[model samples]
Target: MTLRHTRPEARPAWRKSSYSHNDGDCVETAPVRASVAIRDSKDLSVGTLAVPHDAWTYMVDALKG
Candidate 1:
């Protein structure tokens, strides 16, 4: 679903994907404890997608396939 930071000002340092397009349609991610936080680069105020560490690895591997 959606994940949100309690304090909007205290956001983690999110990094945009290298494959992101020049347009605003990009995704950003930040590493949290045992999980990864994903969000839209164009709208950080919306919310985040929290993926577990193992799940993230699996998803990446699958995408590379």
Candidate 2:
């Protein structure tokens, strides 16, 4: 199952994805609690999708392999 939530008033250090482009297709991520927060780089007010650290790590590793 996945968790869904919104960004808090005090935001963390969000970083855009390396695969992002100037055409507005990009994602920003930040580490929060035991999960990683993800949001659209073009719009901060949209909300965030936070996923577990293990899920994030596994996805990243799979992408690299």
Candidate 3:
């Protein structure tokens, strides 16, 4: 499936990973429209990834493994 590129301004909220460290390691997420928005905690303005709720859950579960 092809993912659409979303503009940063289009995102309503942004969240950071609780497990993130200040040493340039971590990710953040927030609800954006019907999906979730993610960005690097270290550089939020630069790297953003938008994912659907179902895919987000699968990604999180995979990360836990």
Candidate 4:
């Protein structure tokens, strides 16, 4: 996959994680280019963390560790 460093002008389609509860502190993710866009569910207007597929996999693995 080709990776391009670009930011979306409009807001991304943010979705709350299934593990999120009504209490808040939710995480959201969206597809942006060849990377996964991650942002706080409460702050959609702010910037998102652009993670490449490989890095995203590593992140998930680390989180599971």
Question: What is candidate 4's lDDT per residue for 1-65, written digit by digit as tens?
Answer: 22234566644566788899887789987776677878776754665788887898898899989
User: Candidate 2, residues 3-65: lDDT per residue as tens digits?
Assistant: 344666555777888889989889988887888988886775777788999999999999999
Candidate 1's C-alpha runs over 4 A off are 1-10
Better of 2 and 4 by TM-score: 2
Give the C-alpha miss distance for residue 22 in model 4, angstroms: 1.4
Ordering by lDDT: 1, 2, 4, 3
Measured with C-alpha atoms, the lDDT of residue 28 in candidate 3 is 68
For each candidate, C-alpha RMSD in Å? 2.7, 4.2, 4.6, 5.6
Pairs with backbone N, CA or C atoms under 3 Å apart (clashes), candidate 2: none
Q: Compose the digit string of candidate 3's lDDT tens values, residues 1-65.
A: 22244786754565657777778688767786777777767665585677899999998899999
lDDT of 4: 0.73
Between prediction 1 and prediction 2, the one with superior TM-score is 1
Name the regions of candidate 4 deviating beyond 4 angstroms. Answer: 1-12
Question: TM-score of each candidate?
Answer: 0.76, 0.72, 0.62, 0.64
Measured with C-alpha atoms, the lDDT of residue 23 in candidate 4 is 77
Summing lDDT over every window of 10 consecutive residues in candidate 4, give the lowest-scoring window: 1-10
